[model samples]
Target: MEHRISKQMIRKIPYFEKMLSHECLESKENKVVLDFDEQAFKIILDWVERDYTIILIEMDYAFDLYELADYLGLDGISKECITYFHKFTIEHLPIIIPKMAKTTKFMTSGALDAFICRHFLDIASSFSKVNRNTKKTFWSKFPIETIEYICALDLMINSEYQVFDAIMDWVLSDSYLRKCHLERLWKLVRWCHLNDKDSSNLVNHLRISAGFEAKLCSPRKADCDCVFNRAKQNCFVMIETLDIKDLRVKVLDNNFKLLVSQVIKEDTSIASNFFHDEHVSDILFDSGRRVIRIDWKQNKYNWAPPLESYAGLQRRIARSVEYGGELYEELELGEDIANGFLLLESTETFDLICFEGKHLHRFSMPIHEIYKRFTTLNNCEATLLNNKIYLLSNKAILYEAHYFL
Candidate 1:
């Protein structure tokens, strides 16, 4: 049967091209019966006719309206329906994201679903600590894309353990759909942060791992500070550096202006020659412990390799505490770093320094970790004060210096 609509209206969607079919052309009624919801079609018809007000009036029925638009080849209306859903998600998505994810209705690869998921994913980090309800959504028909995105965030998770828990929940929820995503998601977890205690816990979960390649992945060294970092309530990242060569330890404010210039009579003799051909790695000043271990990375002899080689030499090593630059004890290190940068009973952990004001490493992780691509920054001078590492990176062309969080 022929449709009463004009050629212009039918041309908008290819689905209506069926009007030119042999049976349709031969029919005398000049009419067609569509196998779609009449209620949804009426709303779409209004939009097609530029009755845009019907969208707001029938906004609550957006899922159905969008379905009808998609089925009937009404992309214009479908797009508008996506815009309408923005407010819905921003206003209501947090509480319902997981619940809705499980449904085949709007959450199953449709324009509306994509739009909502994208918006939610963008602000996922801003989610106030994951609660019981939000956690439920993790195991629901959560979008695999959202799962991957969350895994990649630098600040989204409070605990890698919780993330592992979520994965376990997700895999158990409906293994058929999510099993394929296991290994792909597993690599994103920062395993090295967990100590032997926590790393051992992951052993059971690794059994079902579907996608990890043995040779392609390696965990970080035992010294990674991820576990300790998770314990911090708030990080005070504002501080200045101390000129190691000078007798006085200089303290700078956030703007890098010299705030306090005071002399520390720690036997300059030992610290003086120490800075000549050496790079200060870390300065541990626990006055409470009455000892300062000035760490430096240098060309130390390692006879383990072929007669003239240093292959297995421990590159990152620290010395014992000293009194007034004079030694109190000999060099000490088995696996030197403990609890990462927050040293033993560390009241003040200072490791940052500026050599001639041109080079520095701020918040530097281990060099071995850097080589393994486990850390983005290789090595830089750092000092810890109150469990906070004051890292320095010189910008000679810019201002003298500045403290930034």
Candidate 2:
């Protein structure tokens, strides 16, 4: 059936040629309906007439244009429409900011500081993960005033540790050094003390004027005493570089050994899962303390308990299961007896697969003897590989299973 356009439809003019080409209207013989605001409809009809009249409405209907453009699949029109709206939004920010600030004032200063700090730090941290040119563009748009404000806010709140770290990184960078000002340096030092408990090192590192050096250091016994004495006084314009090779060497050795122990523990726990299954037959090896069982029926598989049960088992075991380089979410077993796989029985199964930034997963399982096995299993690690899950026990033995959903 033919649809009649009302004479009052204002949008019918300029948008007519464009609307007719939409895929939604391609089958013209079929019944069609057009919905729009009464005022907008009238303006459209006015544009359609011989007179090329433009209507300026007080209401900035930018969002409406975007919604309509996207809904109609007007790719070219959508871009042009959004571009105009974006310009309008930017031009109107002065009017919007005060209104937003008033409504947002009830928000705690700490919370606002945290929100802004997180946003800026996220932008800074994302640099390495994106393309090099994109990283440059991101930094270019991020104003120095915004960075300074974030740094100042961090100093005021003294809660967000990552923001503090990001600010310190900027302070230490060559770019920051080139643009360094006395006020900025003072603010940085003040912020360092506010956020970090151990600011002696950072305070000592600041490049201050010789006259201000005394203010940064502790007063001599002969001088006037103040409770808030500076930690140290030597502030030279040139920063001293320390040889970090020895420190790096020590950290590497200790860290490597710790990592190795964690791996072995996780592997042992995963291996122990072999014993949990009653279907397994034959103990292949017994060292009095630990026994290795063989599951001949379900294909040859070996099992043994993990070496030790420690507090850091969850993280260590997860790394071990992912040693072959698979990604999986780590789930905390709420009760002593809970099954991990049973939790993914619902439609939202994808949420169970942990990705970076998602640290927690909650799921329920039926009470069973297997649940007891889970409680006994310490340092539990789990990962999804090739659509199957590999869970490691406290003793570092691995259990292979599949996603129920």
Candidate 3:
């Protein structure tokens, strides 16, 4: 059996044109036999004929088409493949990354590579959520270079422990030979990010292994603002107004476990919300656009000088989030930016807005309507910790919580 296409139409592609133009076997015989996906070849023909109405591509086949298009020097389809991949969810990454890593074209492009690194946390977390067998299978098939790139990323939101667990899982899957990679991979884990107990345990366990050595040093000082380096250090601070003059401050870890709960006397009217000072690592409460120090360790809250009083202060935290982009969708604009998402706050709704140029991806949070009857985002003190948004009401109740990507 043979598929016949117009020679003129086929030659529109550079790969086919070059082959047929020169004194090649295809040109001499006036026929070309090629091994490729039939659907992809048909799509290429449709592209050549400008038959836009009949051309349709699916996610699974897009990769095959992309590889074939790239091989055939089809820049239009190659760029389309890149655009398709940009819309990929975290789950799609584990499937595509291994393939991308092996392709030289993908390596040279570096666009998709950066996407994987940027969303490394979601990808790693997706791995963790899967069963052990599935996770092992994933890591076993993953390219070492891609894994190393993910491990070495300074932009990850997942704790270093998760990164350590992922690498160890990969090593333990094929311990005999892969163990050699353990030392290099172990060095990539940001030891400073691990808690005291976990760090000590890891050090002790590795020290017992013969010929294992590493420098347990400071936290990774990344240039970009990741969730870890941001003002909120993976913990949400909830400000609760108790009576007229006191505010109860509670610090909750990523799991919403209470780490610190203390009541301090302050003018609750003015000190309604808080912001982070990344430089000093302080959770300073905002009072009339001024800074106030609440030394929770000492169980005291004191008013500090006005923000202007601190002359030459660089990187001042903005009192309000500015919504400057064009409204691409009909959803209400958000009042604050958390985890790189704009949030719309109102008594009836809480929404997460992903404002990409000329487009908006709005995620309406699943807050019970009954809760919305009495609760409002404006009335709650909102904070982001470990990629989850926490809305704590003035009454000290956990109003609503949602995870943002």
| Predicted model with the maximum TM-score | 3
Best by lDDT: 3
lDDT of 3 by residue, 1-405 (tens): 367777787887889899988889888887778788788777777776784334456665677788789889978878887666534433344455556545434333244544444434434433222232333333454556667866765543446676777787677778787888888888777677677998888887677752576567665555322234321245778878788768788889888999988897753333222221211123343311335556544555655543232210111111111211222342232332222233443211233444333233444331122222222123335544444445444466553344433
Q: Candidate 1 vs candidate 3: which has greater lDDT?
A: 3
- All candidates: TM-score: 0.31, 0.29, 0.41
The positional error of residue 372 in candidate 3, measured at the CA in angstroms, is: 15
After superposition, candidate 1 runs with Cα above 4 Å error: 1-46, 49-53, 56-83, 90-139, 208-405
- The sequence of per-residue lDDT tens digits that candidate 1 reaches over residues 193-277 is 5566766657654763554442222335455334433322222222123353324345464456666454443233343211121
Please state the error at residue 248 of candidate 2 in Å. Answer: 46
Query: Listing every candidate in turn, what is its Cα RMSD in Å to the true structure after a full C-alpha superposition?
Result: 22.5, 22.7, 17.0
Q: Which order, best to worst by TM-score?
A: 3, 1, 2
Q: Residues 1-405, candidate 2: write the lDDT tens digits.
A: 223554344334334445555655533653446675444444434434634454333224433444444554545444654444323212232222233343221223343443333234333433321232332222223345545654553332223334435554554454544344433534433432232454443445443421233144233444423333122211212111134211111111322432111001112222332113333322211111233333323333333432221111212112111111123345453323233321122211111222122233322112222223222212355544445666555666655555432
Deviation in angstroms for 43 in model 1?
A: 7.0
In candidate 3, which residue pairs get closer than 3 Å at backbone N, Cα or C atoms, i.e. clash?
none
Evaluate all candidate structures by whole-model CA lDDT and list the values in order.
0.39, 0.34, 0.52
Worst 10 residues of 3 by lDDT: 312-321
